[model samples]
Target chain A: MSEEKKIIICRCNDVTLEEIEALIDQGITDIETIKRLLRIGMGPCQGRTCLPMVISIIARKTGKSPDEIKLPATRIPVRPVPAGVLVGEIDEE
Target chain B: MKNRAEVIVIGGGSTGTSIAYHLAKLGVDVVLVEKGYLGSGSTFRCATGIRQQFTDEANIKLMRYNVERWKKLSEELEYDVNFKQTGYLFLATTEEEVEAFKENIKLHNKFGVPTRLITPEEAKEIVPPLNADEFLAGQWNPTDGKANPFKTVFAFARKAKELGAEIYEYTEITGIIVENKEIKGVKTNRGTIKADVVVNAANAWAPILNEMAGLDREFIPIKPFKHQLVKTEPLKEGQIEPLVCPPAWNDSYVLQDGEDGGVLCGTGLEYGPTYDMTPTYEFLREVLKWATRIIPALKYAHIIRQWAGFYAKTPDSNPAIGKINYIDGFYIAAGFSGHGFMMAPGVGEAMAELIVKGKSHVPLDWEWYDPHRFERGELRSTAFQIG
Candidate 1:
């Protein structure tokens, strides 16, 4: 079976392993840290895929618990809503 | 009959408003001019995800400062920004991806951002509904969360106004008048206003403004890319927790929006040739597919709505900040891609510090984001890429 064709994280930006490792070597060690460092997992998807992988890497390198690392935050419109919808609904609440 | 301010700002988006707020707090006579309502630009259209995990110290420090301010934004401004620390999670599916996460976690720790790497199992523990078999590893930061972008922007603007700053909305800036290598003032629809300095916080429109000032800044080959997000009917029970998926593998993210009851969801829509912000059937299908794969429960929810916005992209996927070398009293806080909202306050504080104290305490190197860097061919690549 094609090894289940692993899911590549950071898809919106096409960030690969080599690039991420280079960032680490350059001194990035946390997912949140790498986020600001490399802008990983901050895309429109908001770290949904690459975040898991980012956590594993940080855990292995830093020897700190993954639970300790904070996750990247999530914002509203969970799905994209049109500007009109946002604007028109101003009085909905 | 009016007092000529020492500094004038253009664009009332998060960057401009925050910069005005910070400068006003420092007792600077600043006027913020916005062509439209505040936060009407990238601020309102942002994903509002503030993160500290970074490969560089400057970014880490910038986010660290912003995150700190976000936590206290409501209290400081006496307006609830609804800043929520919903926590963020990043998942990696390959060895190559895992390596990058490792390095980033270390850097965050060094910089004092509480970030940690987690196992797929542990990741599932935090976000109980995730499909653990889908990824190799993940990263987590509990303090990372989202806030109301509109209220956040308003909060800053209101505070700045109260502190003696004049914010002019519905006023468009036509150009920056530079005389003898120094800023003369800015030309707007309302007329010309003289000032010693001008900062461009126009977000996606920054390049045009930069060109107006005769400064050469690529400001990230930003094309207004459209993205889609959906909100479901309010959940009957606690069926969801706020969570973000690593964009590397998943196209969608699922999170809860506090007592608002609806589950907020978003995804990087597959790229299309045009910069159109219109919604498409293709995006809806893609979002449903990924949302189901990551969080199977999403299958039960009904998507109540959808919307679109633009991200100011860069060639290297990073932001262009700081002052222009060729122009005196000209600065930038643009090209944030989509991270502008989360990074707005910090960008504001940095610009304010630079403006008031003539330097930043966090040492954001002016050279890295120098408008001339692209000309010198000294551009660096970035790892984060999303729609």
Candidate 2:
């Protein structure tokens, strides 16, 4: 189970459990702050891949429930949309 | 932490970083603080449309100067900003809009913008995929272009740092210390920095910073509206000619990104003032509805991502620049209403001149953008504002 400490949590941004622990050691407890510092959830998936893992990591590190730690603000287009589709290009069936 | 700087510019977005770069170039001890990483605010999410096609003479002139600077920006910053002068095409569907565009073209021409009112046929020549039947006339400016916002902000920040300006990211400004209406310093979560000059280039958060300075009622409130934009998968290079804007179609505009060839698009739909950066499914539907009609080829492209950013809007869409009379050395370079990213270079140059020489060397009428304009009821609004 010691290997889990070095396991990658955010595959999109290449964030790992050890990296999150390093940031938490620097007094960065908030999920949003941790996200900003480590780019934990700012990747293509917009935290979908790593947010749950990060919340659990934070919860375990600070000895608190995952519900106690506030979730980061959810922003637009929930899924990754191509740049071309943004201007007018829609996927034609 | 050095704990002191001659000038503390809050918010390390396009505006703040530009100001810091310019001030540092002029040998001012400037310190820039950002709550998040650089360009993490509206800068990262901006549509990156750079245009000089404005109805008002002031805005036209301001953007004209900005576009000129943009032309040489990459060379000056020693970075490829991906500035493509693909031109901005404004399609006028109604006769009234066409007539309004003719007047705007005249104003643009007077300011050396080189904008011309072209026939529908000519518009199609510029953008081959444009549906000529949809519009009566088109206002085309060949010089107006788009820049890579991320690269541009980093270029400025890098140059500023190289010139001895200190930038602190992940630092949130909590309070402003003003003694007897004179500028003293600012209190950040990190520590209090004693600064004689403080410029609130915080965009959407400018009003809160203003309130912290004890000048709550002095400046007009800058409300932030969630402006959403979507990017499609990379298309073939040179497939689209320029930024195709159909103002009549809910102010929707589309352009191909020069760096990645992705079709970047947005609309001017008013979502009111909110901090919600969540992109709505409705926005995607609405933007596509008009966009597909304008360029039928776009219907085949797949949307890759959608994101929302804030447009710090004032009562008048124009930004508030210059120092307030009440607060000594407390300056403002915000409230751009989505145009801040495009006007960053011009605003940075002008603000630096104002700070160093006590007046703007640029020909722009800085008084029109004074923070007290709302109180004096001298609000000057621009007619053409693309989302």
Candidate 3:
């Protein structure tokens, strides 16, 4: 069943189910390096829309339950903010 | 994997993996043990600037060798590590910085690295988006560039594995098995793996590992200093090829090649030697203030994340490499300060030579990185460091 599915798992990074599966096949089970490599869970959404599915993909590959997998650390600014605003340089546009 | 090996390399960052690859290439039974996943340490968190621009002869020569290796690393490792020689541009703001660039350029010239002191106008031609009026002059080197840290690290690791070296990730080293001041092996969470030579490439965790081997701070002093950086969303490839940074006075740099195209900017927060990885909002403002000043267009970009990591800083900001005189079969290659990722190739190659032939063939090689030199009160000049 080597089918090319266009299933998008990490929308922020445009990471797909096939892409995550390929990394798992390479034995990269750690979510940190996985995120670093594929840019998953690192976009503006910050894993809000994709982390659950990404974790499930890894868990299924590693033979662990979805709940057993830990989510990646959430970064600051919980929502995306223009960097200039932080320095008091608000864009009029 | 195996219960024993001829050499046990601790850590799995760029340094440790590079050491493992070089050692394995030299035909050694090497086993590298890491506390976390591969490249989970500072290697993954580095600013990804590789350059030969330094203020000292020892550093200049070492980095020259490193740059040569970096240029051909992809073909050598049989992996695309994304190394680009887009060159690195240093903004000389102060009169003193301009003078230092002259001497440093001459030193780099002697070491066969073609770094030139250019005007601010010439600097803007290299990076079009740069706000040129902020700095007085510039230091331009076409050889210095950037590489994806994780890709380079994994290339070495994967190649090392292909060369028959066992790399145990997520395998924590609980203790060092030393007998009669000689390295016997290491006690890991997995089990004991015996080896004649044990290399402490543990980066920020080097001091603790050395302590387990009974080589205290008095023996080889190293402290961890935490630094933070932020990366924006990718724009377009090759938009910011050269790494842009202000000189010795300030601690910030902007590069467009952080993540294929994401404009990356970094700065050291107001902190001393500590291992705190908390990315603060204050730092975001501080780094952005400098970054936007350099390239005003960056203000429009959104930062995807802000992450922090440690710089295993020696007192002199140089790495403690080579065999430790205090321990019989123990070697160290940590405390690279902030430039370890860029220096990994040179350090790895020279260390491998020293281990196999008992002496390194490279210039300013492993012996110069005397681990116990601090104990003797002989400190080296700090390398030219920027964010």
Candidate 4:
């Protein structure tokens, strides 16, 4: 029987480890550039699920500390909210 | 470490990359520095609508040249930009809007833009899903369309690199080294780069860069506003036609993505100046209400994702593109408001010409878009600004 393909990274955008490795092989070293090229951390979750994994991958491949591999800029509203809530249409639960 | 370049452009969005490409093509040693990835700013979040329809002649003429350039962009850049001239349909709901469109079409025709005021039935014929009864008339322009922003920016970046331009990613410009009102160089997080000329194409973050050079007061009129857009699940191709816009309906617009069949929709929410790019549920509810009302079929479409971006809005809703007279080698190409992506090509070509040849090859009144216009109380406003 054939082995099942493991889905380990970027489940929101369906970016796998193999794809990330391929981009790294092509001389893309920056985490932000990789995110833009592969749309890995750009899904609705906004990199929450896969950013740490991507940082580790880059650190390992580049032989640098994870701290040296800077993460992408994080903007406000850390949590995704419905449009209504953003516009002050708060529901009293 | 220290580096030297003739010109340093401080942004990696479409405008900055295009400027770098044009400058490199002109044989100028240019380096483009991006704090983030290319197109990670407003370029990636744009609705990608490229239209020539405008109320003012200057804007129409600029867009006319831009549209022409967009048509041959793929060939010039040696990359497929996926520019589809699917047409733009501007619906008029009231008699007042119809009258306004009549004048708009007249101006459009004067500038050689092939736009015509069509009846409600003709509008339906173009976009079958449109509710014809909701509109009185619509102005349709066949040449207006959408392009893939990611491909377009990469095309410019690749071409620029091919033409001997250096691009530095993950490089942040922390300060501008200015002395006696002359640009010396830019201090970056990576290292200080000595540059005689500097172009501020930072878009939403233009104010910060301008402030670093002590030119913040001149750029005070430029502000940032957050706009949200939602994408629905991919549907059958040809289910929708043309970018349908109801300007009278709070500046709401809808279009189907060319690469993916997802229906993209958004509206001009009355959000104040903010750096927050949070997608609001109010925007989703409002956009869907207006979208489904226009195309009833959209009611069944489920929103897969929503995102927000900042528009570097100017007081006049027009861009500030020209050399700053007070500063010798500092050029401003920042205040594009919401239409930077559409206007990037023209602005790039003009800025390159001005920098290399000391004047634009195009017959644009460069003084009209001067960065110092706000200080002089001279503002040229555009009428057809949608969210």
Best candidate, DockQ: 3
The candidate scoring highest on lDDT is 3
Q: Is the docking of candidate 3 incorrect, acceptable, medium or high quality?
A: medium
Those runs of model 3 whose alpha carbons end farther than 4 Å from true positions after fitting are: A1-4, A91-93
- Candidate 2 chain B lowest-lDDT run of ten: B232-241
Question: What tens-digit string does per-residue lDDT give for candidate 1 at B236-262?
Answer: 434445565766745467776543445
- Residue B17, model 3: Cα distance from true site in angstroms: 0.6
Q: Write the per-residue lDDT of candidate 3 for residues B81-198, one digit (tens) a residue.
A: 8888888888887898899888878988988999998998998888888888878999899999889888898899999999999999889999999899788999999999999899
For model 4, what is the error of residue B1's alpha carbon versus the real structure, in angstroms, after optimal superposition? 6.5
Task: Compute fnat per model.
Answer: 0.02, 0.36, 0.76, 0.03
Clashing residue pairs for model 3: none
Task: Report, to 2 decimal places, the DockQ of model 4.
Answer: 0.15
Clashes of 3: 0
Interface RMSD of 3: 1.5
Worst 10 residues of 4 chain B by lDDT: B378-387
For model 2, what is the C-alpha lDDT against the true structure? 0.83
Q: After superposition, how far is residue B107 of candidate 1 from its true place, in Å?
A: 2.7
Question: Could you give the CAPRI-style class of model 1?
Answer: incorrect
Give per-residue CA lDDT, model 4, range B1-387, as digits (tens).
Answer: 339999999999999999999999999999999997898878988888888897787788888999989999989999888898999999998999999999989889988998999999998888888898999999999999888888888889989989999999879999999999999999999999999999999988888898899875545477889888887655777766478998988888889887667788888884768888777767778887787778877765655678888878888888888988878899979878888898888889999999999998765567777788888888886536763
Q: Candidate 1, B288: how far from true, in Å?
A: 2.1
Off by over 4 Å in 1: A1-93, B1-3, B216-221, B236-240, B258-261, B270-275
Error of 3 at B164 (Å): 1.3
